[model samples]
Target: MGLAVSGGPDSLALLLLAHAAMPGNIAVLSIDHGLRLEANNEVALVEGICLQLGVPFTGVRVDVGPGNVQAKARDARYAALARWAQEDGVGAIATAHHADDQAETLLMRLARGSGMAGLAGVRSWSSLPNSDIPLIRPLLWARKGELEALVGDAGILAVNDPSNSNRAFDRVRVRDHLAKHDWLDAEALASSAGHLAEGWRALEWYAELDWAEMVAPDPDAAVQPALQYCVNVPRTIQIETVCRIIAELGGRVTRSEAGRAADRLWRGNNASIGGVLAMAGVEKVAKVGVEMRVWRFSPEPPRNAH
Candidate 1:
């Protein structure tokens, strides 16, 4: 396994615990996102510790794309880590994502009016962004204070990132708010996020079943290919089914987009979303002995130039 270390208190404790448990089975990967001048020094701190522990270490530098510095940097970081893992023959990667992070994520998503999936927060086990490499969070159950104490007890000095204290960032703001609230239980909130994740998985499973039963391809194949979905199901199932069709038709649809598209289709109206066009119609279902509402999804055509 590969451990992602940032020389922060949480990740430093992660490195220590993982090395203690797995010994030589793990290697450390530190990504320099090129956003901070202190990033190289932080990576050096992690590297020094890795050397002292007799573990292999690699430092990777990545260029974050324009727009949304934090989001872009995260994407670049994970992409670089995935490439490093592939080259180093690592099967999986682990990161330090503890309960406090999970709680903040849940709160942030909630503030954004997120649905069940988005509100589920960061997953403990997921694939790297745009890659199939397995990513694991072995410290989801641990608290931030606990990890800090662990590093303190071991006499390990962790680097403090300035951005973490900057109120300009949403995460930092949330962290500050969480710190001020003595009544909020971050561990319980993390557990709630876990339960929501389970609910999301259940929704995905049901959506698959609905897709298998109520979806089909347009019979005429000479023109543009389209997917037809029977829309007589429940609203949640309809939204999930439409999401799958939109994704299959080469469009990325978010939960809110799917919900809106499903609503438009339910009213027998045409709607466009995520580069896909959803046209509502009716079909005679011999099996159901009735007329069924249907939605046909196809790629949106290029707009005519005036």
Candidate 2:
């Protein structure tokens, strides 16, 4: 496995500790976006650190100057990591994101009226399409404070990324606000998110049961087994069932919208999730079919995946 080293304090601490523990088992992968003049220097610093620790180092430079800087940079960084791992025949890719990042993600998604999936935050492991390789998070249980404290306890200096403090970013907004609340709220929020995720899982489990019994494969949207498998499920389990089916078939679902629509399946005669519209046609056999939302004839695998 490799650590994505940006010279940030938490990542640096993770790198140092991983080296101290695993020794030769781990290496550092640094990507320079060339956004600042000091970017390359930052990579050099991480490389020097790796050399001192007798760990191998590889550096990649990405051109992320167009489109959304943050989004494109993230895409490029992961793409480089995935490419390097594939070439090296590595089993996994490790990132520096910690519990704090997860918490912030949950909060942001919640503020946007996200459902359980968003609140669950990113999973610790992401399975690559048609590959056994996965993106793994070793620091999932660690917090930014713990990682920072590691650096301080070891008497090591780690560079701070100024972009983290900029309020222009939505993450910064959530992070800054999370900076003020008591641990009770933060921990409670996390706990609540966990509960929500559990609920989502349970709902999906029920949906799977329902689908097996009622749904059939569709070849066409207007014909049998044309595009996807169609199910005549009750409004009670519509969105969750749909989301579960989509996920199993390697597709994306809007959790928040879907959850809301599911909640309203009984109250309203019609509800739509991701353009998959459902109307109350029957209740006993749960005869409900989708009309618009998101439907693809065929879906492609995740690009630049592990």
Candidate 3:
């Protein structure tokens, strides 16, 4: 396993705790996003800690774009860390994402009306996509203050990322909100995100099964590369099924548009998703009818909105 150390108390403590638990089994890695002025010095501090601990260490300085800097830096950081683990033949990557981080992410997703996917929060363990590597988080039980205390007790000074304090960021805003309110209260925030995860899995099973029954292959479905599916598509289930199809291909659809589509299906009116699709042999069937089939396609097109 490899540990992703960012010189922050959370990750640094993770590195130390992991090593103390499994000596000689974990390697420490830090990615310098090069965003803040103190970033280089922070990398140096990480190196110093790794040296004193006799742990193998490496660093990467990334020039993430100014606009969307956080997103870009996060992407680049993960890419670099994953590449490092792969080169070192590490089987998994573990970090210090705790229960608080999970709560914050869930709240932010809730504000955006994020559905099941967002409500589920981060996974405790999962395999990297298209790779043999697994990602793990062991500090899910530790609070941020506890991690900080552990780091201080170890005589390691942590570099505070100012982004954590910035109110402009959604995470910071949500964190502040969670701090002010008692998240344990039922109405305070959805306490069921954990249970929502279970429901999400069950719903996913039903959605996939029902989608297969209601939808069919339509290569020439839409401009966005969706598939076509035939369905009896009861009036009550039309809107939900359309939303499901879009989501199945990782598309974000709004409730208003879903409602319009549903109303069309129930009223037996025409509905179009702005794509001229092809059927068994007939072409340009954007609107599904009684004998008409719904159009969908594979997600291969380049669209910015998605």
Candidate 4:
């Protein structure tokens, strides 16, 4: 098993527990974002802990370019972990995202008006964008305080990340808001996330059936294989089908992006999303009292040379 450790209380607790549960079979992986002055020291501390525990340790330095720092940092962390997993032949990577994190994620996505997939929030297991290795969150049922208590009980001195309290981040804001609302149970919110995950899975199930029944590679296109889908179904089915097609092409399109693209196609307008072009046929057909929309998706052609 591969454990992602940051020397923080939650992650250190995970490290201790995982090492105890899977002794002699666990590897610890840590990523230094290069943004914090103490990041290198943190990685060193985690490495020393792993060394003391007799577990193999790998430390990676990641560059988080200008953008949403937290989001970009997360992307970089997953990319580094994926590379490490490939090199080590590890099947999965584990993180210590606990119940409090799950609640924060659900609230954040809810505030953003996210759909079921987004509201699912910090799944226990998911694949990173453009990666096949599974990312596992084993401590989703535990709270951050509980994990910190465990670290204290084990006599482990964990590093505190200052950015976690910085109000500039939306997650931090949500965490603070949740903290103020003492009556709101983080565990209940996390349970709602699990329920939403089930709903998302059901949507994917229907989308798969729709894909098998209506979607295919466009054989008539001059360029390489493009996607073609029979879009005579309901709007929800069309949107979900488009998402699936984009996912298949290694393009990650958000729900709103897919919905807008599908809407444009339904309106007989050509749309492009994530380098995937959707063209709607003007000549429509009516079958069984419903108007049929046939849309074809292909890679956007390169611009003409001057």
lDDT of 3 at 193: 58
The TM-score that candidate 4 achieves is 0.89
Score candidate 1 by lDDT: 0.89
Ten residues in sequence with the least summed lDDT for candidate 3 = 274-283
The local distance difference test score of each candidate is 0.89, 0.69, 0.71, 0.87
Q: Which of the numbered candidates is closest to the native, going by highest lDDT?
A: 1
Q: How well does each candidate superpose onto the true structure, as a TM-score?
A: 0.94, 0.74, 0.72, 0.89
> Which candidate has the highest TM-score of all?
1
Ranking of predictions according to lDDT: 1, 4, 3, 2
Give, for candidate 1, the lowest lDDT window spanning 10 residues: 218-227
Candidate 2 lDDT tens digits, 1-306: 778889888788878778888889987889999788888989998998889888889998998858887988887887788788888776677777677877887888978976555667766677544456687767767778899998788776787678888899999988888888676355556556557667767766777787676555545444222233333455546666656655554556775565665555445445544434444333232244435222222333234957
> What would the per-residue lDDT of candidate 1 be over residues 225-283, giving only the tens digit for each residue?
68888767678778888878888888898878889888888888999999988889898
On TM-score, who's better, 3 or 4? 4
